[model samples]
Target: MAEERQRIRVEFAYDGGPYHGWAKQPGLPTVQAALEDALAMIIRQPIATVVAGRTDAGVHANQQVVHADIPADIWATVPRNAPLAPAPAMLRRLNGVLAKDHPGIIVHQIQEVPRVFDARFSAVRREYSYQIADGLARWNPLYRHIRWQHREELNVEHMNIGAQDLLGLHDFLSFCRPRPHSTTIRTLEELSFSRLPDGAIKARIIADAFCHNMVRALIAACVQVGAGQRPPAWLGERLAAAERTSETKLAPAHGLVLEKVSYPSCEQWAARAEQTRARRDS
Candidate 1:
């Protein structure tokens, strides 16, 4: 049975505010549990999911993808093998199961992908967004755990200048939590800010990979620059220094959202489709 097994890939999204993060915790609800529970109901067996990123609590995912190994026998029980139906119809059933138990969780799409297509390692880029509402309005209850409220006026120009320093490949020791097996090296592809219609400011960042708490720490540094407490040029120096200094502060987790994940063009789409078909038809 293991020899005939194939991997299943799924794209999902969630509001992370109420959970203890993406992974399962001993005493807290998590996105993983919700997904696994739904999968168990569908397949009539325990299911484990592997995510692209184990986002911290209060961090939302606009579109996150995960992969799991499902027996071909299980896949065959769905749409394609059903008297006569297209493969896409399977997604609807999966969503229905997920929606019943996981409120606020949405399964956007599901399809089988190559065994080599690891949700984490195969990802080419990850984009994140952070919202900051300046002044008293940032304290509004509606925005709790989603927006960072700053009661001080900010100098956007200075913040932009500081963020520019993080645009290239560099060792991000200062912004990351030190982990023994961690590599602080990463290439930042893009970073910029824009004002929202509601007078809140948002920081958009994209990178090949991020270190633990890297985005939060980067935002915290930017806030210091915006508030005139840190020189705008200091960010550039920190990126070059590759040193973790005591002054580095990780921003609050609530303000960050995992916006998207990118991958190489689907040259292997044909292979994936064929494998998917076999699993569904078997």
Candidate 2:
């Protein structure tokens, strides 16, 4: 038998404010719907997509990768009647359709990857950046889609110290939105804060995987600590409790952006990735 044709991987970026979320819905606009529609037009088939992260509505993605399995024989049929090649041109074409079909969404890039590569499971680390514009005049019109405007003075030093507590493996129940029968264990590789010259603060978080609303809530908790509303050790205590509580507020999704996703370097972790997928499906 011939070797199975691998799934074609596609990376795209989008402003998630208009769509309900990443998943497809009955009557609501979604990123999945927009992409699937564009894929159907491009490949002339019923295409299904698996995303790296299912970002909440109003969240943004600087880099979101997805995979779709298309037939090897179908490559010849792709509309090559454009200036750019099939993959790149498809992005342009998809953007055009998005401009007409799904407003306020764009496909940045598309590429092919190995068959075993899974967009979600293959990811080893996912990075998210949240921007806060503090004491700002005219905020970045370009960054408005992916930033939160907080005029209040923030103690960046305090926030940095609090963020350091979040590093390493922990049961992040406090930061995560509770899910019935779901494990909240995650390994946070990095959590750091940076102060920009324009008086904006940027919070960057890297994790193997994130539970629902974890990053936003983490930022909220850190912000509270920075503002003196909560003590710096409060997050550490909350993590120790492993109790799911709403005491921590979830920051607005507009400020969050999916920055990048790093995949596993070895095959040993494939089993864990597979298990993660199975758990998500279940």
Candidate 3:
């Protein structure tokens, strides 16, 4: 009989400062390239991985999700419950590969998942955050890479008011780079802004899916409102336009981070994927 295939899911985090985003590109470092290389070494064959989100260049992820398939022969030899107690030998081995070559990336957990689970299509929501170091926050070196340095003062209350207008289902074309062949409609579950204890502005957005540059674009629009350059009502006005707006600035990718991906119960994985794909494709 043919060797059975095992579908495995991995949760990991990476500092995007050195890599060129999550997807592999020619002549550039990428999270996917580094991961596939390590997997190839472990399985003794070429390997492919699917991610829940394709983060832009310079965008970090705290709990990025990925899924891969391997042959039973390869899976049988890898210990699933050894080498570090709960962390399987396979998981430790993969981390070893990451530490040696891709030190910025690390795998936290790995386990066999249902065959129907697809990291990208099966996801129900994605959470992202952006940091702006304005006011006195520019002096913090610890957040240099993850926080954008904005010189102008930002009103957190104003930003929050503008953010509330963006929460809900709408065609976010005004906040996304044009994707002519794809839909821009998305259900924004959450959009809020707060002043971090360190005086930095933290903006969080949650949505079913995002188009190119959407999160950063949304941040920029809200910043303009916070800076008193635009009225809080402008966001709703732009949403009604349903087209890309030249007035909105695109924020730097370095300040954005993919925080998490959520999904339904294992039994509903296939159904969720089906509905998500159908809507996304339409």
- In model 2, which runs have C-alpha deviations exceeding 4 angstroms? 1-6, 79-89, 135-145, 265-272, 275-282
CA lDDT of every candidate: 0.81, 0.80, 0.88
Candidates in descending lDDT order: 3, 1, 2
Q: Using alpha carbons, what is the TM-score of model 1? A: 0.88
156-268: candidate 1 lDDT, tens digit per residue: 88999888888887889988886675677788988787788887889999997788889988998989888898899988887877778887887788899999987765675
RMSD values for the candidates in order, in angstroms, are 6.1, 3.1, 2.1
Who is ahead in lDDT, 2 or 3?
3
Query: Alpha-carbon error at 276 in model 3, in Å?
Result: 0.6
Model 1 misplaced regions, further than 4 Å: 80-90, 137-140, 268-282
Candidate 3 — which residues are off by over 4 angstroms? 1-3, 80-87, 136-138
Give me the candidate number with maximum lDDT. Answer: 3
Query: Residue by residue across 1-282, what tens digits does model 3's lDDT show?
Result: 766888889999999999999999999999999999998998899989999989989999999999999897778777655544322776889999899989999899998888899999999999999999986635478878998888888988888887888899898988898667788899999989888887788888999989888998899999899888998988888888888757868888889999999999999999999998899779
Residue 149 lDDT in candidate 1: 86
Q: Given candidate 2, what's the lDDT at residue 220?
A: 85
Judged by TM-score, which candidate is best?
3
* Alpha-carbon TM-score of each model against the true structure: 0.88, 0.87, 0.94
